[model samples]
Target: MPDRIRVLHVDDDPAVVEAATSALEQEHCGITVETATNVADGIERLDSEAFDCVVAGYDLPEQTGVEFLDAVRKRSPDLPFILFTSEGNEAAASDAISAGVTDYLRVDGGAEPYARLAHTVVDAVERTVDDIKHVQNTRRERAIEELHSTARAFMRATTEDAVAQITVDTARAILNMPANGVHFADGDSLYPVAWTARVEELLGTPPAFEAGESLAWQAFETGEARVHDDITSIPGRYNPETDIRSEIILPLGDHGVLLIGSCETGAFDDTDVTLARTLSVHATAALNRLDRDRQLREEREFIDQALDTLDDLFYVIDTDGSLRRWNERIPEVTGYSDEEIDEMSVSEFFPGDEHETIGAAIAETQTSGRVTVEAEILTADGERVPYEFAGTRLTDADGTTAGTVGIGRDISQRRAYERQLERKNERLDEFTSIVSHDLRNPLAVAEGNLELARTECDSDALDKVSRAHERMRALIDDLLTFARAGETATDIESVTLADIVEDCWQTVEGPRATLVVEDDRQIRADTAKLRRLLSNLVRNSVEHGSADAQTPSGHTAEHDGESITVRVGIVEDADRHGFYVADDGPGIPEDDREQVFEEGYSTGENGTGFGLKIVQRLAEVHGWTITATESEAGGARFEVTGLEPA
Candidate 1:
C-alpha cells in the first residue's frame, strides 16, 4: 500500500470544496486533498500530476462527476476513481457504474461519510497495485524458464560460432531484444560473428571493433558489463549518429563481448541487463569447453606421433590380457600384421613356456602398479628372441587398475655383454688364487730362510730380504681386496657409525692418535664391507699421522707421523647425507687429491698405494660417493655421501 494517498476533489462551491478537503484530510492521516472548482480544472490537474484516486461532486460547473471520471479513465485506465455527490438518483448511479467508477457514494453531511470514502480509495489503489505485480511476476517466471532452455542449447554447442549465434538469438527471443550481436575476440580486434536481423535493419551491419575503437572493446578489455541508457551521452560511442539509442555491452570473459541495442531511449532496464548477463555466462563456459577439447585433440595427436617413432615395441593392454594399443615396432618385430596383433593377447606373442611368467608379471603389475621381467618373444617363424619388458599399471578415475602400458626392449646385445663379463671374471678369480697360494708359499719359504740366516750371521742384507717378502705379501692382500670391492653390494643392513669407528680404531695400531666421533647416525651398508672400509681408513690415518712411525714395506705418508686427532662426524647437506673422517695431521696437497684414489699411485717409498683405492671401490659397491678435501683443522678430510638412513 502507498504510504500516502493523494486525492483530487472537484465541486462548483468554494465552501463545499473547502469542507470536503478538510473532511477527507481529517478522515485519515495518510490522505491528502487537492481542490478544483470545476471539471476542467480537475481534468487538467489529473493530466499534469500523479494522484492515487479522483473525487468529484455530481454537480460540477461544466460536467457531472461521471464525465470527469471518464476523462481520468481515458488517460489511466486502472487509476481509482470515486463519484462522491450530495445528489442521489438511481439513474445517476447506473451511469457512474457504466463509466467504470471504482466506488460510488453519497456525500452526506457528516465526517463518517468522508472516512468511508477515504477507506474505499485506499482499497482500490492497493488492489490495482497487486494486480500489476501478479502480471509482472508471471512474465518474469516465464522468461526464466526460457533462459533455462536456451542454456541447455548452449551446452550442446560444439563450436565457438554455434555458441555466439545462440547467444544472439536468445537475447532476441527471450529478452525481447532484437537489435543484438556477438563479436568474438581475435588478435588485436573483436570480429563480428553473429547478429540478429533487426540489428542490420536498424543500424546496418555491425563493424569489427579494433583495439580501443568502441565501447564494446572497452567492456571486453575491462571485463565489466556496461549499460548505456543513451548512446549520445557516451563520449566514445562507435556510431554516435546511428539510429540505436541505448545499448548493453557485456564482456564474455576472454572470448569477446555481447552487444544489445535498442532504437528507443531507456529501452533496456535492470531486467534486460540481468538476463543478458546470464546468457553471456553460459556462452563463455561453452567457448572454454570447446577450447579445451581442441587442445586435448592436439595433445593426443602429438602423443600418437611420438609413440610411433619408438624403436622398441610399445603396447597397452587391458586387464583382460587383450591388447588395446601398440606402436608400429610391435607388428614389425613380431612379424605379424597389425590386425593380427590387435586380436591376439599379450601371452600369445610369447612362447608357451613363457606364458606363465608373462601372466605372473602382468598380475604383479596390477597389484604393485609396476613390474619388469625378461622373457623370450616367439616370432611368426617360431624363433625366440630375448626381450626385457617393463610395464606400469594404468588406473581409471576411480583408481581401479584398468590396464597396463609398457614397452618391450630387445636384450640380445645386453645378454652377449653379460656372457663376456662372466668369462672375464672367471679368469680374474683364477689369477687371484695363484697370487694367494702359489706366490704366498714361495715367499714364506724365503722368509724362513732369511730368519735362519739372521740368527746365524746378523746381516742387514737378510733384513732387506725379509722386508721384500713382507711387501709382496701386502700387495697380494690389497689386490684380493680390490677385486672383491668392485662387486655390487647386495647384503645391506643398517649399522651405527660410532660403533664401526670405535671397532676400526681398536683394530688399528694408533696408540698416539685420538679418535673423536662427532656423529652416531645409523646408515645402510653391508656390515662386513663397512667394517673393512672403515678399518683401512682408520689405519691410514694412524700410520700417516704418527710423527716417529717408520714406513712399512711399501706404505708411506705425506706428513711426518706424529700424535694426531681424527674426527668422525655426520655430513648433512641439501643433496647428500653421510659421514666424514678428518684428521689433524698434514693434509694431502689439492693437486694430489684426485690421483690419490688411483691404483698403485703413491709418493712415498715402500708404499702399497692401494688403501685409498680400496676405499673408493667399497664406496662404489654401496652406491656411495667419496670426496677428499682439506679439513677445518688443515688435515685430510674424506666425506662419504649418498647414504640411506636406517
Candidate 2:
C-alpha cells in the first residue's frame, strides 16, 4: 500500500549515516531514508521495521558489514543492500563484495562517496520495485486467463453440478487461495453445493447458515464482496482458533455465492473483487439455462403419459408414414403390438378398398392444418373393421407440417352384423322369384281347370275334370313345399341324411323302377327340408328318365336291369360328399344342364321344372352348394358340395 520506498542506512559512524541520508535524499527514486548508527542498532532496526534498500559500512567496531549483510540476507533475502566503506579498506571491501553485497563505495574526501552510495541505493531500489511489479503483472494476467477458461467451461456445462465445480476450480486458481467453493442459495440460506479437496481437508464441513447466519450469506444478500484478513485473529472468522489467516466471499448473483479462504493475511485485494463480479454473470446465465431444461423435460413426460392412456390406436408418424410414437391402446384396437406397428406402414393397416381414402385424408389434413376422419380399415387379423380415424398435422416452429398424429377405434362387430343383413336381403330376392315362377303357375292352372269344370258337359267331362283337378292339386302341393325350402333354418340339426333318402325312396310311386341307395358319411341338416329335397329329386328323375326314354345326346341307354335303373348313391368329389341321383337312361342335353336347376326350366314332356330348382334352393339354404353335371350312367348328376357337417 506504500507509495514511497523506505531506505535504511546502517554504518558505524553517525556522521557517515548523516552524510549518506543527505546525499541519497536528493535522488528522486521515491525513497524515504531511516538511519542506524551501528551493526547492532541496524540489526535491531531491521528486525523492528521494513525497508526497500539498506546502505551499510564494511569495517565496524563490533561487527563487519559482511556479517551484517549475511544477517540481512538471512532475514530478508530479496531486499537490496549496499556497502559504504573507507578508502583504505579495499581488502575488507573486496571480501564484503564477494559475500554478496549489493554495491560498494569508497569515501576518499568530501561528499563524493555518500553521493555515489545514494546513487547505488537508488538503482537497487528501482530494480527491486521493477521486479515486484513484474511478478504482480504476471499474476494478474494468469488470473485473467483462468477466468476465461472457467467461463468457457461454464458455457459447456449442461448441469448444475458441472457449473458449480467449474466455479470452485476457477476461484481457487485465480484467487491463489485455499479452501475455495461454491454455495447455492436455498430459500433464505446459502449452503455448500460444490467445493475443492482443500476445502474439505482444511475448512472441514461447511456450516449451515440462514439469511444472516454467516459472513458469506450476509455478503451475498448485500451484493458487496467481503474479506476476512485473519481468521485466527478476527472475531467473526469461521474458526478463530485455527491457523487460517484470511478469506474472500463474493456473491454469485441471485442464485449462489463463492467462498475463498487463504493462509496469508490480507491476501485478497480489488483484483479479486473485479474477477468475482465478472464470474457472477456467467454463473447466472448457466443457472437460467438449467431451469429451462428441467421444465422442458417435465413437459415431455406429461405428454407421453397422456397419450399412453388413451383408448385408441394413436400414432405419431413422419410424412412418409414411418412410425415415430405409439400409444398403449394401439395394440388393443388394431390387433398389432407396439413392436409390430413400428415396422408396419400406415397404408398396410388399411383395407385394400379403403387404403386410398385414408391416404387422401392424411394428405388433406397435412395441407390444410386441420383434422381429418376416415372409416374402414383392414385389421392385422385380415378382418374388415369399421374405423373412425382422425388425424391432425403437427407443425414445427417454422410452420411446416413435420408429421401427422392420428387415432382410430375398432368397429368390426358392427360391420359383421351389417354383412349378415345384406345376405338376408339376397335370400329374400330369391324367395320372391320362386313365388312368382313356381307358386303362381300352379295356382293359375287350378283356376283354369275349375273354370272348365263349370262349363263342361256329360260323363267324359267328369273324368277329364277329375284328371285336371288331380294334376292341379299335385302342382299346388309341390309349389308350397318348394317355397318353404328357401327360408333359413336357425336350428342346426345334426340329422342322419340317410334316413331322409330312405324315406323319399319308400314314398316314390315308380313301380317299374329299381331303387339302388348307397350311403357313407352322415350330414347335418333340417330333416324335413332334406326329405323334401330328396323327394323332389327322386320323383323328377323317375318321371324324366322313363323306361322308354331316349338320349338327348343321341347315345343309347345301357342298363343292367330289364327295367329303368334309378341309382341314388354317395360319392366323393374333391372335399365334398353328396348323394347323386344317377339313372341308366339318356343323359340330359349339354345345353340344358345349367338351365335345368333355374326356376321354370324343364326337360321332360309333362315335367314341372320346380323339382331341380327346389333342389338347388334347398342346397343353398342349408349352407350347401350344388352343381348339375352329366353322370357316369349317361343321366343327370346333381353334385351338391359344401355338405360338411357344422
**Highest TM-score against the true fold, candidate:** 1
TM-score, every prediction = 0.67, 0.51
True-structure RMSD for candidate 1: 8.1
CA RMSD of each candidate after superposition? 8.1, 22.7
lDDT of 1 at 428: 80
lDDT of 2 by residue, 73-150 (tens): 887776888877673376777777777777777766455776777677777877877877777678778877877777
C-alpha lDDT values of all predictions:
0.85, 0.74
Model 1 Cα lDDT, one tens digit per residue, 364-412:
9999889999999999989899999999999999998889999999999
Q: Which whole-number lDDT from 0 to 100 does residue 223 have in model 2?
A: 84
Once superposed on the true structure, which residue ranges of model 2 sit more than 4 Å away at CA?
A: 1-3, 8-13, 34-166, 169-175, 193-197, 200-202, 227-242, 269-289, 312-315, 319-321, 324-354, 375-390, 405-646
Candidate 2 residue pairs in backbone clash: 351-378
